[model samples]
Target: MKMHLWSEFIAVIKKEVVPALGCTEPISVALAAAIAAQKLSGKVQKIAVCVSPNLMKNGMGVGVPGTGMVGLPIAAAVGAIAGDPTAGLEVLKRITPKDVIQAKALLNCDSVSVNVADVSYTLYAKVTVSSGIDFITVTIADSHTQVLSIEENGVSTYIAPQFCSKKPQSYDPFKDIVVKDLYDFAVNIPISYISFIEQAQTLNEALSIEGLTENYGLQVGMTFQRNIERGLLSHGLLTDVIMHTSAAADARMDGAMKTAMSNSGSGNQGITATVPVVVAAAYLGVGKDKTLRALVFSHLVAIYIKSQQHKLSALCGASTAAMGAAAAITFLLGGNYQQISHSLSSMIADIAGIICDGAKPSCALKVSSAAGAAVKAALLALDGMHASGDDGIVTNDVDQSIQNLCALVNGSMMQTDVQILDIMINK
Candidate 1:
């Protein structure tokens, strides 16, 4: 029964935790536009896009997959011109050079303007399109790709928030994975089932090395790796794992064409969680079976931690990923379930409130530092040195500890979210 439950859990996680084509914010914009455009059912002559400051700020600096452009205008334009809503987060995957040209034309016509919405929601985007004879407006809010309302001409063809009663839900592949179930899947799943984990290794390791050669993100991972050359840090599994994990963030944020397997809609989270374990496996010369288990632990733990926080929180998603990385590293270092919980607890206490400013090349450094801290936390746990409940936010029970983290991000951090966005906009 336990094995069956775990298998089912892993299935759900694998389905939810997959690759996303672009940065989630602009993709949400394009997705809303595509739906509205499809509803128009005619030639799209004009398109207008309105977005919240948070969405605009994030979408402003990140790359739209397969297109070299950044920001909401192009993403909105492409959505109106060529995007398919059915593609989900990868909505703009089919964009072509012709589509890019057409999108630019739409922008040149002064059709896209980003403005703050009166609503105080963390996630929001509204797209309105006008064809020759028809006009449609679509609104996405509170969650990425949540189309709250839709109208065509004067008719409300789709009334979502009222008639439709579901909150905007993200693609959560790890929704059902419990810690024990993940452990079982790691220990018993066929090696073939997790061969994809190796790709995380290849892609991320390349990025870490590239980061050292060039300026990538905070250069935290590369800087640490370089310490080995200077004899400041020892050459070992920890160094190797951090290097590989951070390198991928460097590449992805710096606009590398290589694809990364994303988790809960962010590629950096996927890299931070998976690459470190993969590097550890390589450095320690671990067998495929053990390696697969460690990778699953890392990935599933990251997914679980992400579930605790609202997808968009005052905190950066990396903090959650770092917790996941820390747990995975604990397992790699021969820590059992108890120690895994300890590492997670330590991570929760330490990095729970790190805010997400935006996705950028500099994110690599943050990822590296987080991964390094995760390693330390895990090592400490393996030695039976865990954060005491009396100190900080650490709790006696692991699940309750995570809930405490969720409270901080979801319940207590609203002001912090607004303030961060305000500062970014002012800067």
Candidate 2:
């Protein structure tokens, strides 16, 4: 790869892969509220938060970190009270017990109101904080943490040109990336440039341990381990992958005060992409360099696939991240590019249409299922078995098959997204 291309790839990875606390949907809300709070001079008396439908859907039931509370109201209240906007997606990292109390009190008083906004973007958050007669507004749109506008006292203070024009240029750094390019980059790229990928292993592994040790969310990982101890499941690579990945999700979805190395704005997706590959690398006795390379492959594949869809979608992101894990596992198993492609195809064929209801404790179950399916797909690929082009969305070309999956999620599942949100809201 050319030095320029390598530099671009590294930059994209750095931007996409970073630490996040709690579910990103709620974090985005909190971040916006925090920014609005920063602009206020007096103590905040009220807050009005509006978000896109996708954001509303995902943030509805997920736990807010350090608050022991679920949904957007508490997230907004805590953010307005104690969140640090400078921390970006990790905005709630500074939330303390006192902050949680204040947030809960604010909720009890009905000082914070959350509603779905009429917005075209998949990711959007607008938070307005009031202190007596003065108010400040902060808006984040397009991507999580991308603040598009800020206003104070009903006056525009700052507005992104793209926000005004409403014709934001699509800047996809991975636009030219294909499966072959990802493989070549993973194997041939200099170690020094991509070595930082190891942080994904470090951060996500800690969350996995935390989940197993404590009863967080569904305790999916702990349950799996207990099942293995009871001789119901084998103690092996597949079990390890499922347990670690699910455990990480369990902690993340349940609002454990730990940072997850998020990919494409999702901690669960990051866990699904990293834990399986890390477990496989350890099981295969791979060294740091090879493990780092495989981790990069897995993350890059997930980022590339997700770049084609909305940031938040009706389709379960774990399935896409699991496809990345399957590719990495295939690479670790000494399978070539063809086999890696086959693994991705197998994954898409099996779990391409799992609808995302919301981000909550049950997400751990979906994460575990995706991880197990990833291992199965990798094994099938290693044995020279794969889903044919005739299978549902699988295509002869791996890249084309990925595009087909994206089309289904982004286009065909549009109504599915709305209906799922309706069901959740009405229920």
lDDT scores of the candidates, listed in order? 0.74, 0.91
Q: How many residue pairs collide in each prediction?
A: 8, 0
Q: After superposition, how far is residue 316 of candidate 2 from its true place, in Å?
A: 0.6
**Tens digits of lDDT, candidate 1, 162-251:** 436655665544455456556666767777777666655555556556666766545666777788889989877667767767877876
Query: Which stretches in model 1 have alpha-carbon errors above 4 Å?
Result: 1-4, 38-45, 146-149, 159-185, 188-235
Highest lDDT against the true fold, candidate: 2
Best by TM-score: 2
Which pairs of residues collide in candidate 1?
A: 13-173, 16-173, 207-247, 208-247, 217-361, 217-362, 316-355, 316-356
Model 1 global lDDT (CA atoms, 0 to 1): 0.74
What lDDT is obtained when candidate 2 is compared to the true structure? 0.91
Candidate 2 lDDT, 5-97, residue by residue in tens: 667778888998999999999999999999999989999999999999889889998988888879999999999999998998899998889
